[model samples]
Target: MRTDRTARTDRTAPVDRTVATAVAAAAAIACLGTLSACGPDNGGDQNAAPGKAASPAATSPAGGTGAGAPQPSAGAAKPSAAGSASAAGTRDIPAGAWIDPRSIPLDATYHWPAPAGAAKSVAGAPTFKLQELCHSKLSPDTADLGTGRAAAQSLAGAGGPDRWQAQQTLLYEGDPRPSSGVAQSAHAVFSDLREEVKACAKTAPGATVKVTGPENADYFAATVTVPQAGGNAVTLHEYLTAPDGTVNELAVWTTGKSGAQPRVPWVGPADADVAKAMDSALCTTLKDC
Candidate 1:
């Protein structure tokens, strides 16, 4: 199996395009015969403030009605003293807080195949807020929510006609204070993402973005289609809040054949599947779900 390895950097800061060139080159080479272009970057940040609910919207270049996305549920399980510390000592993240990569469903097709081996762990870094998802602009209040413990994994397609990549991140905020404190912080991050998606649709000229799910839903999905010379690059970004105040992000990138539209599957596993997996991974150490 061919592998493209690049130097690791701080995930908290904006992604450096220079460092991403190697991965991009790998993707381009993988799609040489079937597709003329490669997909977009796979790095991302998860942070935002609580806002209003979001309205369901369709594919359009003029943006969608993502007003106030769903905030963190007040009824979410809160972390306890025992859950906050391990046998050794207090920890930023309790054991088993990170999601299991194998649990996530993959969209393996002839054009875009899934990775053969298990996902590889990237560098861990502090969590920071983003101004929008499409661009790498950082929000002024990036530090307002405070830093959270973060871990990420990257998975590349085995060897397919069309190159593809997937990234998964777990951001855990273990504020032992009551429910409101932690819930509010998580909700804020979700809200920011909702608004950023809307902004990306409006500002990006040749790009079309569609956001799905109701305003009150705990999880929402967004798809961005960027027109390239020979084909279009499509990306699916999905977000959801875990029962224990952890933010789970799944991003998939794929490209279409020349003069064709990309047809990658929606975000990733169903929201229910992700929630169940996260519950099993997090509830053991964070709180009783």
Candidate 2:
């Protein structure tokens, strides 16, 4: 039950500055902990095509939002939080509170009935725009920690007290269409700051994490990220189960590797054996993980 030691996808040597800041702070806390840190998680597919371009951190569910399936497995295993409301409508998600929602990043999924009115934000890195419950259940690594936790804050404008406020997302993939039409994941969510997250709506509650529907977009979404490592405010959550019964989910956020100092990945809760050794080394080097 103690397996969180990985960083050798073939990294060789010369990375020891105290384990390279604890393996880059555990890969920047797993890209701000919980399924994100550097790149390729999600982007594109909110209805898609306003700007369409994420593929950074937090990238999620750019599923086929799934058709041929097979092309939507970039990064989706954050799972940290340990708060324990007992998972049935848990609640905490506010961020900017110095964090500790039991660790955040319950990896994304849930999705049942939520999201009925307004859910579409865009701010990032320097601020935040994951906007009011961007369709509920999001964890896709919170889309790479929403622009490296908003560039790791302290921009001198976030209104004080250890500012680093996270909140990034893109999330899309209810299987709208994807025979590789591109659009792998999106359904992102990050929290650490809060000018106003609408009082943090019952927050956590886990168990496939409480997500709903009617949110917009159709399905099958993706854009890119997860070839070598995607980036940007990182948020990407994805889950699929289609065979007529139904049970699909998506979430995405983006940003990273542009100039450093974005920093976020700081995870400490471990399991899934380093994400099954990063998806069995990404399905043996892209043979399909």
Candidate 3:
């Protein structure tokens, strides 16, 4: 396949422009995406005096909601619709939407944000966040896109004996806007990233960037390399949009420096795998795609 490569200087501008807008929109869907926290312990007596000995009565109150009292049956608690939806896992993903996971590399261990430790390894250095690979720019301000917890997913793999590491993820932003608005918003983000890639080509001096387009007529791929003192890393980013304004992104990057074998082999999915994932019914909400 043909790969369009270039170098660019400015990369953070596109990210800054949309962060404020996207974060603002984040408030709207925060509840939907946020995870539940562990509730505080109820073992302590609320009315106990500091440094005071607890009276026998305080230790065990009759008919109180304490551990000593007869506990309420688990059946008494109510289940929330949101909790149920998240547990279902298929909330946005339609049946048979994903390519057979078997087709992906056998060693690829699917992780939500790659391995957590990978991020902490390169402190005080020019390390890249996984978000940067997918979210280059924010969706349109007026676009009602939902960035729910269930809306994002990722996978990581240890490259086979090559010390290469690969990671891929998808961001499903559900847009509640009308067709005109949804189309405009999706196109806006895509155009923004395209322009950013082009702009980067001219500025990054020695860095190498290859941009390829309209994959399956629905996706775009960009490969970037930023040269540094010791060695540089290569990152492959893929972007896709569904008819219902759901945006899917896929990325795989090397963990090792340029010219050296990677320590962890990347077993993440390939461009074709990413395309298959986007084609699946990811984020197919009721009455939406």
Q: TM-scores for all candidates?
A: 0.51, 0.18, 0.44
Clashing pairs counted in every model = 7, 111, 18
* Cα lDDT, all candidates: 0.42, 0.24, 0.36
Q: Rank the candidates by lDDT, best first.
A: 1, 3, 2
Q: lDDT, candidate 3, residue 224?
A: 66
Count of backbone collisions in candidate 1: 7
The alpha-carbon root-mean-square deviation between model 2 and the true structure, to one decimal in Å, is 27.3
Query: How would you encode candidate 2's per-residue C-alpha lDDT over 1-289 as one tens digit per residue?
Result: 1332344622545555557777666776666644343235453344442222223111121110111011122233222122222132211111121112222233222111211111121123222232223223333553332321111111111212212232222222222233221223222221222211222233411112222212232222221122112422222232121111111222233344423332434232232222232223212322222
Model 3: CA > 4 A from native: 1-83, 86-155, 158-172, 175-179, 202-205, 214-216, 237-239, 259-273, 283-289
Stretches of candidate 1 exceeding 4 Å from the true structure: 1-95, 100-103, 107-133, 136-138, 150-161, 176-179, 228-231, 242-244, 257-269, 275-280
| lDDT of each residue in 115-232, candidate 1, tens digit only | 2123222222222122223553324563343233322232445534345555444444433233455565556655665566666655555666676555676665655665445455
So what's the TM-score on candidate 2?
0.18
lDDT of 2 at 252: 30
Please give the ranking of all candidate structures by TM-score, highest first, separated by commas: 1, 3, 2
For residues 101-215, what per-residue lDDT tens digits would candidate 3 score against the true structure? 4433433544333221121111011112222433333335522222221222323555433343443332222232422454444455445444555455455546556665543
**Candidates 1 and 2: which is better by lDDT?**
1
The best candidate in terms of TM-score: 1
Using lDDT as the yardstick, the better of models 1 and 3 is 1
